[model samples]
Target chain A: MAKRQLLLLSSSQLHGYEFLEFASRDITDFLSKNKVSTVLFVPFAIKDHNAYLKKVEKPLNQWGFKVEGIHNQENPVDAVEKAEAIFIGGGNTFRLLKALYDTKLVTAIRTRVLEEGVPYMGASAGTNVATRSINTTNDMPIVYPPSFEALKLVPFNINPHYIDAEPNSKHKGETREDRIRQYLEEKDSCTVLGLREGALLHVEGYNAVLKGFTGAKLFVRDQEPVEMKIGEDVSYLFKDCA
Target chain B: MAKRQLLLLSSSQLHGYEFLEFASRDITDFLSKNKVSTVLFVPFAIKDHNAYLKKVEKPLNQWGFKVEGIHNQENPVDAVEKAEAIFIGGGNTFRLLKALYDTKLVTAIRTRVLEEGVPYMGASAGTNVATRSINTTNDMPIVYPPSFEALKLVPFNINPHYIDAEPNSKHKGETREDRIRQYLEEKDSCTVLGLREGALLHVEGYNAVLKGFTGAKLFVRDQEPVEMKIGEDVSYLFKDCA
Candidate 1:
């Protein structure tokens, strides 16, 4: 099989950065190097369709690629099968996964990306569904999908926008780290890649790498979280993870 | 049905307060008026059994109530059925809900509290599950339960530990308000009560009131969030909520 190409981003924009500014260059290069002309965009995560499309168009247009919202097409599955590349935007994970499942596009997208090697780029909630299950998401469960299962494009799960606790804050809610630790206790076999903002996991077939301006935290069941330096090899996450 | 008696707390402890200190007075008063002796404690949310039981025993004992862990009982359903009062502690909501389903205790607890007039007290995750569903919880999914449907003791959903966005922070993730807004968009009929820390909602039959040190924000579908006074009546939540 052709090496699977996936760019799973923690978020669309980092602190003080313009929309998609942090990952714009990487995204543009990914599309350009592949000689892609148009990319199919999944905007199901956000409720506002016009605003999401407008924001996505400007950046991708600057990168010399045409973008179309899948929701506008006659058949979303057909569109995915024929798309040169696919981009899923960020918003609510439950809504996004439900949309994907509702339209029967999960299998179509998985086949295109994993089997046919179509380029897949997603941010935030979009990045979450690229994993085995949406169980590790930080978003509210505003809506329940058919199941917690996702595309299963990757072996383990991804916790996007992984942030540490506020040092001086006295809030009683559990920190992001504590929530993930509880997740590990329930799911011992699955590993969770805590992708901090401004970082991403890049998968090229069997080899996956931690990339971008910042590092990420890797959490496995029963083990302390290990920090992955930028550019560090994370291919092991793909091993025995699925 | 007997008048429903429930104490849905946002958290067990606030900063600079002992365990259950913030709500200790109200708790003791409620139990005392009911003439309750031994209370059954549901500690399924946390993984550590001993630690949870130890922490709970201290505070309830101070109030002259004997606390027993429901997990230690041979029949959890029978224990809840016979209990004078039930206290569910805070932790991961998903785990707690899943455990309740796995052990078939959801029905037993509901019957005990709703029919038998046994007082139901819960903090954080426990509070989340007392409503129609656990969709408004802040904790990560972590694990999948049989369903997101929760104990329908209350008409509307309770979002515990509900804090506003950091004023000057650079975090790009959605704020608590933004998330609740999205939830309303999807669930227009349901009302969400954002109970801030150091606050709680006390339900007595068809009447519910916001009590404690701080006010709460009520989010209804397509309406601006209304700020509820600390002692304001919230019986409206029980009206059309279901």
Candidate 2:
């Protein structure tokens, strides 16, 4: 099998920064290193695909890459199959997964990224679908897809935009840590990677590295979460992945 | 058909208060007015149902009602059918709904509450399941339930512990309003009730009333959300309910 390539970002835009500004250099480096020119963008996560495409195109265009939305294509699967690189933007996780299933692009995109070695980049919801399932997503169930099963391009699930509990807040709701803990309570075998904002994970075949500005929380069943900073090799997480 | 009696609370406990302290009066009154003495408690939302029952029993017992956990019963459906009243406490929504389906208590509880007029009280996750669906819940989707389709004892969906956006916050995740709007964007026909902390809805047959300390926001498709305060009669929301 070809070396699977994936770039999963916790978020697209950071506070006080332009869209994708926080990771502009990392994104460009990933694409350029892969020798990518034209990019296929999946904007199905948001309600208006065209508007989402426009927002994404401005940055990629400045980076000297032509961006095309999969929604604009006659056949989305064909677009994924023929694309040099694929970038799925963030919005609502359920909506994105539903559209992927509706357009029959799950298998096609999975095959392209894992087997054909097509460079795949994802932010937030996009990062969510690249995992085994979207159960740990913070997005509401605005729409119910056929299943919570995702692309499974990676072995572990990613909780993007992961935040810590406010020290002084008096809210009675479960904290982010509590939610992730509860997730482990239900599915103990699966691991969850809580990617803080401005954090990203880069994977090439089984070699995964924690990248970007911020740190991440690695959650395993029945164990204390390990704090991982940027520039750390997290490839050991893929030891059990086939 | 018998009068459907229900009291759905935004949360079981308010910040800085003991469990159920904030809504203790409302709960007691609702049960008292309905002439209920024995309450069957559905503690399936939490992992340890026995511990959940112990916490809830303290408050209800002090109010002079016998509290029994459905988990201790041989058949959960039989427990629901024979109860004078039913109370579901707060926890994870997905786990609660899945347990309801697993125990075959969905139809049983619906019949007991709607057809037999058994007084039903729910807090947080419990309040979510009392509605048409659990799609609006704030809880993480730790486990995949058979469906998002809920009890439907009420026509409109209830979003318990609904909070507004932090004005000065830098987090880019979608706000509560954005989530509800997104839900409407997907399913335009459904309505969502955003119940703030310390808020609740009391339903008697076709009459519904907003009660407790705080207020609620009512969302309709393509319409501005209306602010509803405590002591307001929200019976109009049940007009379309059969």
Give the count of colliding residue pairs in each prediction.
Answer: 0, 0
Please state the CAPRI-style docking class of candidate 2. medium
lDDT of each model, Cα atoms only?
0.89, 0.90
The residue-by-residue lDDT of candidate 1 on A131-161, one tens digit each, is 9999889999998888899998897999999
lDDT by residue (tens digit), candidate 2, B1-242: 24799999999978877889888888889999989889999998999888999999998899899999998999888888789999998999999999999999999999988899999999999999999888889888888888899998998888899888889988888889998888888843388899998999988888889998889999887899999999999888876433
Error of 1 at B225 (Å): 0.8
- Interface RMSD to the true structure, each candidate: 0.8, 0.9
Clashing pairs in 2: none
Q: How big is the positional error of residue B193 in model 2, measured in Å on the Cα after superposition?
A: 0.8
Q: Which residues of candidate 2, in runs, are more than 4 Å off?
A: A240-242, B240-242
Those runs of model 1 whose alpha carbons end farther than 4 Å from true positions after fitting are: none
* DockQ for candidate 1: 0.87
